[model samples]
Target: MFLNLLTLGVLSLLEGRFPARRDPGQRPLNMAIWLVNFASASAAPLVMGAVVAFSRRTGLPAFPVDAWPPVLAAAAYIVAMDLGECLFHRAQHAIPVLWRMHSLHHSDPCMNASTTVRHFWGDVLIKALTIWPVAAIAFRPTPSTLAVYVLISLYHYFSHANLAVNYGRWSWVLNSPAYHRIHHSREPQHYGVNFAGLFPIFDVILGSYQVPDVTPQTGLDETPRGLFQALAWPARSTPGRSAAQGVGAALKAPS
Candidate 1:
């Protein structure tokens, strides 16, 4: 717990020290994103706690790893975790209704550490429910699984930040902030690309990955209610905004 707090503080200071990127507080929409995600993260541990307890009580293994080799056990855990995450990510895009809930996370106008917290609780619930099946049958969730999860999450937190760090050619295998910036792109063309969380091997292999050097112009251009609206904007509707912006711009133009 202390380590996490320390990481947050240290990374925040490093970002401030090393870069001239715009801060979240300067943008109302970004602030809203932070609020929503921060609130959800506050409850994340509790949800994880419940899952752990449930796994502990209801889950049991008939045969121990006494016979199973260590290397193979670790390998299986890593494969299962990566496959589960890859599939979960794909599902988020393939399913439209679910995308509505996920749009809140993508709503960040700018990326940063705080952007990691900008997810809707409903989406988190769906995630937990979806991944529970794998956790149920795992018998004993290996340490490799937990290690990979933590490392991947840390990488994601970095990806959302505007650190401007790069791994050059390694970006092909490892996800970088610049790579994920394209994922948050406002242009419709880039929506489904860059699905891999930790590594781009999956995305590249599937022919869904693209690399561009431009920083994305974020915020849903079609909607005024982006992060700030609907949550607080009276009568603000994103569906109406996205729809009306297409057919007749002048007629729907707000004063």
Candidate 2:
């Protein structure tokens, strides 16, 4: 699982760092900002690992991954984890605070394979805070279980890509880029739809699944983030910030 996640993350970095133009006007995402995001968001797994290890070594059982109550078996836990992620990802869209943290990801003007790597550091911190489900799968995980984690992550990357992978019936069963592109779409209607990481079933059950009746083209269309600004975006963008900007922009007189 570790190797697979490592591979997928590296590929995401490469694509975001050296992006291909889908349109003539689109600029590649700024590398420095992307790095900050990558570094910040990617810190979670490492942090989670350190926390779990330190807890065990210090003999602190509270919040220990190994100390999870046996509420459900491993198999059930995996299924629950998928649902939890879907729910959590959806909440990032539904909740205003989470969306503020997540907006850096959508700030990418263009949607492509590389855009998947663009993220805010706060999101990474959130991920580390949310990794208990993995620990629940195992206090000491097996190779197969780890593989499952990697599989879902890779599946997640592709879902965010701007590729044209036609998955017919499978698209109904699994989350596809076609399905996921809607989540990244600038259109207001598609803004928060389709939040599944792997299993679309969770979305279906939760009534968040949305399949577009017509195909939508994908690519980066926004001005790419400048190196310094993107890195500072989360820090500077307070809840009042968005509100002030929205109201201030509206109050501006027409040119």
TM-score against truth, every candidate: 0.69, 0.67
**Could you give me the TM-score of model 2 versus the true structure?**
0.67
Q: Give the C-alpha miss distance for residue 114 in model 1, angstroms.
A: 1.2
Query: What Cα-based lDDT does every candidate model obtain?
Result: 0.58, 0.56
**What range of 10 consecutive residues in model 2 has the weakest lDDT sum?**
245-254
Worst 10 residues of 1 by lDDT: 246-255
The global Cα lDDT (0 to 1) of model 2 is: 0.56
Q: Candidate 1 overall Cα lDDT vs. reference?
A: 0.58
Determine the backbone clash count of candidate 1. 1
Which pairs of residues collide in model 2? 16-114, 109-220, 109-221, 109-222, 110-219, 110-220, 110-221, 111-219, 111-220
| Top candidate by TM-score | 1
- lDDT by residue (1-255, candidate 1, tens digit) is 354445556667877887425634223554465566566656754676576667668754423543578666655655565556666766665555555555555655566665666665566666655563454246355557556556546656777666777666677778887787776666655566776777777777666677746666554543334754524432334543222212222122111
Stretches off by above 4 angstroms in model 1 are 20-72, 143-148, 222-236, 240-255
Per-residue lDDT tens digits of candidate 2, residues 1-255? Answer: 355356556655665555332532122443444555666556766777776677657665433334455433344556656776776676666566666656666666556555566666677687676755245423444456556655656666666655555466566588776777766655544544667777777766766667744345442233334766565555653544232222122122212
